[model samples]
Target: ELSGQWLAHVIQTMRLTYESLTALEIPNDMLQTIQDLILDLRVRCVMVTLQHTAEEIKRLAEKEDWIVDNEGLTSLPCQFEQCIVRSLQSLKGVLECKPGEASVFQQPKTQEEVCQLSIHIMQIFVHCLEQLSAKPDADVDTAHLSMDVSSPDLFGSIHEDISLTSEQRLLIVLSNCCYLERHTFLNIAEHFEKHNFQGIEKITQVSMASLKELDQRLFENYIELKADPIVGSLEPGIYAGYFDWKDCLPPTGVRNYLKEALVNIIAVHAEVFTISKELVPRVLSKVVEAVSEELSRLMQCVSSFSKNGALQARLEICALRDTVAVHLTSESKSSFKQALEALPQLSSGADKKLLEELLNKFKSSMHLQLTCFQAAAPPMMKT
Candidate 1:
């Protein structure tokens, strides 16, 4: 007992001495000498302590907050929530608790506990948001908040000279939320659309535009890839002016190119089709909402161009329109049969009678076509 008490007193004395040395505002030369002395003392003490068991070392470590002085990456005091996340990263795939490592996603034993933990984290994020939203020159009271925002803080500071509108700030929030939970962010996006948050719609348009550009570039690369070697090798000069060999090479190139081209084309088209289906309705809605009434009406007219065409022509037109719209519309959405039905009746004459007869005979065909198009049209918001 006496020995243990003596050791504790020695430790405390060394700790205070170190603190006092650190607090001294000495000249650089004296400071370096003091720092070297402190390091030597610490190293000797640590070497002597190695004789202690692992459990003793661990207990000491736990009691001392050994990592509290980690390089000051942030102005804030050390945060418990961030500490938990960092611990998780350190132990990932290396250490496992008997039940499981605690995590934000682990199932809580009690609903109250789960709710409490969730609310705690949410409050932390909200507080961080408040700090970020303060005036550019406002002093951020980091001690008041919890949560990791290092990257966001850096990014926000770089843009401090410029003003961010509410929508832009909302976009930043949404982007961070996506990095956290993609599916949840998408659900929130849909809800924003439902609630008429048109900025969300604008974001959707921008996303679709990016996807479309990527698809186009990919397709061009694919085509050029397919065309290159075949076209190059088939040149007569390259083949030593052997016309027959040139013919053979061209045919071979065509065969290989077609095979690879077909696969690449399909892949590119599938990606574009998927993106178009996702973006068109969202984008189209925003465009229509923002455009002049004349432009909006023009779009509607173009959509209805063949409403008065002959039965076969109308059927083809309806099919095409439905294809574009179906990507945007929901499954429960009514088919756009009204567009077909809205075709004006012909004025009386032999031509009119012939048209009327044709319409009656192909009404079922028109209905089928309209059903197909309606299924296609109303879903996407693409341009």
Candidate 2:
């Protein structure tokens, strides 16, 4: 059943993509009405896909019912699912009527109409997820999940039935809401942060830039920027002001867990955005920490095993660990250099000497202890 659903969604997405491409080629004035229709259908398709994807995730979670029962599996995606649903549910009244040959259909009179028409297709795509699995009417509490479909006015009463992915759907809803009431984006961002939805937190962070398009409306919404000290001082330019991806640090100090999650998110953005220098060090530090921790764990596990080939595997693990550790050392060389450079400048000669001694102790440990352990391991096993 799951396989069939997956195939169906994939096929639908392909169909919509093809159709949208076709509309893109048609002359703007000649294809205005038809384009709106195509866009709406595409949105419906995206929603269907989101709903199905959410269902598949839920099915897998259910298959591991024992683990889920003992330690509840997260149902956070469902709330995102509903947000998409409400986005579509709110688009009902806003129809994309293409002006007849003599009609002024190509241009929208108000910003609201422009938003409704532009975002129509994407919203349909996200809302289609409702078909994936039956969802409860009441809310569920799960970490990193939030639903802000409470105010019908928030969506402005359109409730169209287009399909869209949760991401694309959220983008469409955000675009329209930001156009109508820029404050809505700020309010939603605050709400999601308070609730701890990291995914939405990142989304809202990027969407805040949409307000820069509005005149004085941008300053009016600046009140919401007061929440995050890190982002509050962000420069008010297109690239820096609202869409500044650098502000995405997870609020965690524990090195291991924080690094792992934060690094993955950074890697994803790096692939997408060609990340700026401001984002590079913060994310690279996390990546370095995560890789080191994983290597350490693998070596410890390999060290304890006594089975055939275990000795060889331990040696291979040691080599990998050394390689990662070296990479980290090289990346953090500047910090190491700064500390070493400050040693001679200390006012207290005795304190400076003590610091030098501690530095020498670290260098000796790295060479004597770590090198000896690596050498003691068996040779690497040939694959």
Candidate 3:
């Protein structure tokens, strides 16, 4: 079944049987019975083909590397797409007879059959995708279980291993889903139209809707995984060394947390761009927006800002703003602006000079990180 040779042979034999049955001058009633049986057989073949496709996709998904990278640094359609295409090709060969080739009974019904098959194929693909990306059930509550604190390193190693594996699986799924939604599925729909398949609109709409919903959910999961840690560092970084926003000295430069956040953000930018340049802008935009909003909330909650503390806060925010300047969406920009407005305005010429110097420093650092990110990207994607 996986080889598809059996399917091709069966289809050819059925075609021959239909032709022979028609040529024999068999009675109309007997002919109808034979035609029905052949049609049933064809339907069974289609079902088997769909089942094989689903199984193939699941098999590929279980592998450590589901995305088949044929060329170094060049994004390719995933193995799942190939599986679907192969199945479609096989079905097309059997279901779509050329002009003057279809049997009398099959002629009038070919378009409708093709349409129904197309929808079924799409449903199978979507079902397989959902299964491939489904998260594992939540772990049983471990709080009640006593911990072996003495084996801290062992426990840490196991946790890290599991986390890394889960992250890689998620990356594979998202990259593949993005490619399918943006490229493969559109091409498939176009092919269906070229074949004059009925129900193309509904098929395309339902499949696209499902893919898009999955894509969005995957994106949100990714953002949470990547951005949460960066956002999580905000409060600690802000209050590092017991630094009080209400009683700090004049700003010297951007704080360590701001620097750390920028570094982490750049790293994520590089990782995502390397994986799929198509995902770079949107993913980075969301991550930056999330971090900015969190920063805004944190600053707003501060009871009061000392004169110097406010100056320091403005400096840090400006540095952050400049660092992610390229990736900022309107929402993130608004968040940053709001956070800045909450700070005491810096009117002193010296304060302005200090802020300028800090901004330049952070911008320089950001430029360096971006340079590294560009270098890491594929040559074709450098633009």
Candidate 4:
């Protein structure tokens, strides 16, 4: 059942015992526990962590100087095969049998019996590892290197009486486990530096002298793009009708939507990069100021299409002022009506709340201006 990151964590911490003789199992443990251990070992083998397990064992052996044989094995004080056989005998105490257990050495009769034997084999393997690490010198003779064995491989040659079932085959594979040889390998991972700095690079690339020029260029380009003219739908233009030309513009005569647009542009920039949100307001205020100043220059010109637009605008204003004078003299309300209707309709297309508020303020201001202008007319007419 163990898999993924949790199993990886376990693997990271697990240490394997090398240069040890196989030994006996602990008493009174369940048969299922041994089976589970074998299954776990099989999982490790399939994942090729047995190679890593060998590396860990080799690491431990090098630290202890346990390597002694021509065959790269620990010089055991006692016979390794005898030790394994003894361990298997001890592990059989877990089985609920009568005083003398006889079936431990014999070929297993059933699949269940085979499973029971396999579990005990795994238990013996584990026990031998513990004994080898704990008491390497107790029975092991330092004078002799490797012990004489009929089969040199850990589990020896398997003399199978019959072809094993798939499950039995798996258990057979697990029996030998991963045999650890005592040769040393350079673990470069131990020397690797830790990566604690999130996404930021720990090293800087360019020198201070070079960085200044690059930073200046970047800043200048950003300013140029941001401070470009606020044209298109936001600008006021001369809307021509079939009969007369209406000079339509927002009363405040500034691009009210540009502030929101600039803010959104900043927000998107922050989204696309690892930027501090706290820096956005400062950058935004500067950008808004620069862009607002650039856009304000357009207010001086009346029509976007003409170079003499400002002159024509002056003439129009003069004409309006004269009309105002005449209206004041005659007590007329026509000029006031035209000015009110000439302003853009915010209710139709202005989606932003700021624009709605600006529109309301403009309405109130224009209304007040016209009302005051008309109120003064009766007096001028009397005069």
Winning candidate number (lDDT): 3
lDDT minimum window of 10 residues, candidate 2: 64-73
Instruction: Write model 2 residue lDDT over 9-116, tens digit each, in one string.
Output: 544564455467565786665455654554454344434444543454344323211111011112223333344444333332222222232211233332233233
Query: Which of candidates 2 and 4 is the stronger one according to TM-score?
Result: 2
Off by over 4 Å in 2: 1-78, 89-107, 112-332, 343-383
Q: What TM-score does each of the candidates earn? A: 0.24, 0.22, 0.74, 0.22
Give the top-scoring candidate (TM-score): 3
Q: How does model 1 score by TM-score?
A: 0.24
Q: Write candidate 1's Cα lDDT for 158-209 as tens digits.
A: 2122333332232232223223233332443453344222345444444434
Question: What RMSD does each model have against the real structure?
Answer: 23.8, 22.5, 9.0, 32.6
lDDT of 3 by residue, 1-383 (tens): 33345765776786677678778887878766765665655655655675666566556534332322311111224455566677767767656653334331244365555556566666666565556556453421111111223343565311111232344445556777776777777887876665445667877887888878877887898899999999999998888799998887877677778878888988887666434555677888999999999999988988898988888888888777766777888999999999998888887898888889877876675676646333234446554
Tell me how far the alpha carbon of residue 213 in candidate 4 is from the true structure, in angstroms, after superposition: 2.0
Q: How many backbone clashes does candidate 3 have?
A: 0
Clashing pairs in 4: 23-87, 23-128, 24-87, 76-140, 77-139, 77-140, 77-141
Error of 3 at 265 (Å): 1.4
Off by over 4 Å in 1: 1-84, 87-115, 123-165, 183-327, 331-336, 339-383
lDDT of 4 by residue, 1-383 (tens): 55323444442333121101112333435434443443343333323332332233333322322332323233221233333333223232222222222222232232233333333332333344433333433443332223224334664422223322222211111111111111110111111112111111111111122223333443444444443433232243332332112333333322235333433444433321212222233333444444333333433332232222323332333223332232232112333233323333324333234444544554354453333123222333543
